[model samples]
Target: MENIRLGGGVLLLVLLAVTSLFVGVIDVTLQNLVDTTSRPQALQTLAESRIPRTLALVLAGSSLAVAGVIMQMLARNRFVEPSTAGTVEAASLGMLLMLLVFPGAPVVVKMLVAALFALVGTALFLRLVRRIPPYSPLLVPLTGIMLGAVIGSLTAFIAYRTNLLQSLGAWRNGDFSLVIAGRYELLWLTFVLAVAAYFAADRFTIAGLGGDVSRNLGLDYDKAMAIGLAIVAAVSAIVVTTVGSIPFLGLVVPNLVSLAIGDNLRRGLPWVALTGALLVLGCDIVGRIIVHPYEIPVGTVFGVLGGAIFLFLLLRRSSRVS
Candidate 1:
């Protein structure tokens, strides 16, 4: 059954990728690909625009979902993710700082700065989690939401003062419409981070068990956590830098996968990636088609759906507790 579901997800992702390639403002058809006259224009659209956008969707979706899994493992809370934990806001602040101070820095430098900020934010979140008593599982995510709100406010204030509020708004709303070949290459770093997570999956699964158990098994608990958090930070930073802040993607995808497949990171990771990619691609397609020639941002679509799912999860948890 699990394998069947996984196979279905991969099939769906392929279908979406193909759909995305041909369903754009500028129509691209197979005939155009072969025709000598229109071949240049069709191929240009495919190579420069559609291909990059699709790749960005896949990389960003998979990376964020995997990051969410790592975060939940390290935090020992299913609700924690990059967006909720203030990582995205921190990365946004870092990008804003880069825009203000270095203004001329390359995209890589901007991403590095954002990653640094995300690391600090994640560390701060973990520190707060440690200080608080885990009386309720819901408390952890609420605290993270509050932390993210604070960071988001600060980011907004900085942007306001710098007269970059409009620019900040654009970055805060994840949109694939602007993606082109050169612009989205930074997301490749996220792909590397995802690969690293796969290799380190066992250590993360053990770490999720708790510090004592991890140490009893001779695993370097702190080192594993550091590595996991680093991956989360890097993924968040790169995705936000390239595609903007995609709300609740990291939150929604992993939790759904965990609910379906159990907490074994090694076994669950691939499903999370496939599901995440499918969800993002599906949302992007819906966004494009819903307005027909005037597209909605993919982030907006996911924000609505993810928020509803998050509410459902919260209510379900509360009901179970009761």
Candidate 2:
């Protein structure tokens, strides 16, 4: 049954990807690809724009989802993700500083700086959460959200003063419209990092059992956490540096999969990845068609949808606890 469902999800993703390819303002159909003269432009569009956009969607979506799984496991909180934990916000700040201080810095430099900030931000969040005296699980997410908001506000204020609000907004509201072959290659790094985390999934799952229990189980809990933070930081940094911040992706996708299939990362990772990719791609398509020539950012659509789901999950958890 799991295999069947996973297979179905992959098929659905392929269909959506095909839809993604042909849904832009400029018409690109099967016939356009076949016609002798039009084929050049059609092929160029597919090669330079549509295909890269689709790949970016999948890579960014899956990376964020997988990062969410790792983060939630390490934090032992279902609601925790990079965006919630100040990782993405920190990355955005790093990118903004990079933009202002060294405007000519290469993308890789910007990404590394962003990753450093993200790592520090995540470490601070985990530290704060740990020090708060064993409390409700809800406090974990609440703390993270608060930390993220603080970082986000600081980033916004900096951008406001520097007259870089437009660039900051672009990063804050992720849109794949400007993604082309060369422009979006950084997102592929996230795929590699996500795969690395998958190989160490058991360590994180064990670590979630708490420090003593994981150590008793022969896992290095602190080491696992450090590695997990790095992975999450790198993934968040790459995504934000490449496309911008995508709100609620890392939070919503993994939690939804866990609710459906249980918290085991090994078993649920595939579903999380697929669902994440699917939701982002579907939202992108909707954003394009919903307004014809004018397009809504994918971040806007997914932010609204994911925000609703986040509220639902929060309320449902609170009700169950009550």
Clashes of each: 0, 0
Candidate 1: the clashing residue pairs are none
**Model 2, which residues run further than 4 Å from truth?**
none
The residue-by-residue lDDT of candidate 1 on 1-322, one tens digit each, is 8889888888889999999999889989999988999999999999999999999999888888999989999889988899889888899999999999999998899999999999999999988988777676778888888998999999999899989998788778889999999999888888888889999999999998889999999999999999998999999999888889778888888889878888788999998888888888999999999899999999999999999999998888889888
Can you tell me which runs of candidate 1 are displaced by over 4 Å? none
Model 2: per-residue Cα lDDT over 14-40, one tens digit each: 999999999998899999999998999
In order of appearance, the predictions have TM-scores of 0.97, 0.97
The lDDT for every candidate, in the order shown, is 0.90, 0.91
Ten residues in sequence with the least summed lDDT for candidate 2: 129-138
**What is candidate 2's TM-score against the reference?**
0.97
